[model samples]
Target: MKHNWTTTKLIAVGAFGVLRVLIWLPFVAINISTSSPLLLIFSFFFFSLISVFSLLTIRQFGTVTIQTFVEWVLELPLPSIAFMPLLFAAAIIRALVVDLLFFFLRTKEAAASIVCGGANSLVLSALTYVVYLVMGIPGTQTIPSAIFTPIGLLLASTVVFDLGSTGGYTGYLVYKKMANTAVMRRIQGAQ
Candidate 1:
């Protein structure tokens, strides 16, 4: 089906994009200022949450069009050219996992949300390491830092799981409730 441009869709896209930024900006700022990965746990969780939010918002309010993706990219404060590959890769992974859960598996629940969120975290994190490798970023890891890095990352993974599952499950439930309410109202109106 052809999706015509409409004001509501434009608004929804813009709104969600801003919301995603609002949710992420503070943590990102902190991470930048401190130059510390200490907050990486919360950052990943928030990032994954917004990533899932982007997918759900797009699915509900906009067409799966290049324009939609472009709008999202334009709305956010992307870091740099070096980050684009990871960003795009994360988006693709999230989209694929979400599509698989909702379209093919017919899962619109917590499990699906958690899975999508976890996949987003895993893909983004793994890609980040790859970028570091390419850039020759040295790991300043002493033995303790090395030991803690994986532990920290693992803990961050749980954040991804919790937030993703909660957001996905709640968002789907709310959407269903609203849809059902609309249907019921229509039926009543016809009566």
Candidate 2:
């Protein structure tokens, strides 16, 4: 089906984009200050929640990806220039994973959300490490160096995957609830 880029849809996308950034700012500050991987558990949860919610609500293929790019633009001046590239890549890859999964799976079920969230988190987390390694940025351990080993990688990946899956499942529940509301019905009808 061909989707129209109506003014209302554009406005909704921009609003959700800003909401994603707002949800991320505190997590970014906490992660930078503490260098704690644990914080990412919450971050990915909300990140996946917002992404899934936007996709389900808008029923648009690029909704999450576009919102993420908007987020990247808004966040450009917040972090150091060195970290911007990693952030840019993460945003694109995460959103793409979610979008592609939804597209291919051809269903907005909870299982799809779970997979999208887990895969999105895992891919971006690995990408961060790879980018850091390639750039050789000193004094930056995206996760603890001790966790760079095979066992550590496995454990960390499992934790993040669970965190993201939980987030996505919760997002699906929230979307389901919101979908039943009059406001959501009207908004969706307008689209």
Candidate 3:
């Protein structure tokens, strides 16, 4: 089965954008409206940053830009949506950083590139998380959230790494081997 990602990719991006809104909707409607800095950051700002950064990275490395852009537009109408101006601003910054890493930093190996991408993403996430704390959000929950950011980064990194790794190559090689050979022989034929 070929991965004709044009339509499938669009659908996936849309679903994830909706998921982003769903995850934050409750936080905005219930908790973050009170103007607490921490609340605002967690429930709204930081998450939007993460979403934009993630989508931008995908667009850069994969052929998913148009789909990502559409989903991002859809997200703007969300009740807790952060201001559009800021989102674009962050997107621009994220894009530049990604370009720097992809062009200036990465070597030929997919694993190294993925690791670099992962590190950059984690740093951005951490910066967003810290911004939340600086706004006076309670560390009780926010603190733990920060701790998990690196782990999330690691997970994303591995997912991308597996995309073109030796393991992935090995799997295809095995499949090819099975398909390329067809034998029907009886071991007792000589008896």
Q: Which structure among the candidates has the greatest lDDT?
A: 2
Clashes in predicted model 2: 0
TM-score of 1: 0.59
lDDT tens per residue, model 3, 34-139: 5433343333332333333333223334322332355457667665445455454444454455445544433433433443344334443444444444444444
* Candidate 1 ranges with C-alpha deviation above 4 Å: 1-11, 50-72, 75-83, 136-156, 173-191
lDDT of 2 by residue, 56-117 (tens): 77777787788878777777676543236765776688788778897776474778778877
Residue-by-residue lDDT tens digits, candidate 1, 140-186: 12113443587876775566566556655555555455544643233
RMSD of each: 5.9, 2.7, 12.8
Specify the highest-TM-score model's number: 2
- Of models 2 and 3, which has the larger TM-score? 2
Q: What is the C-alpha lDDT of each candidate?
A: 0.50, 0.73, 0.42
lDDT of 3: 0.42
- Worst lDDT window (10 residues) for model 2? 1-10
The lDDT, on a scale of 0 to 1, for candidate 2 is 0.73
What lDDT does model 1 reach? Answer: 0.50
TM per prediction: 0.59, 0.84, 0.39
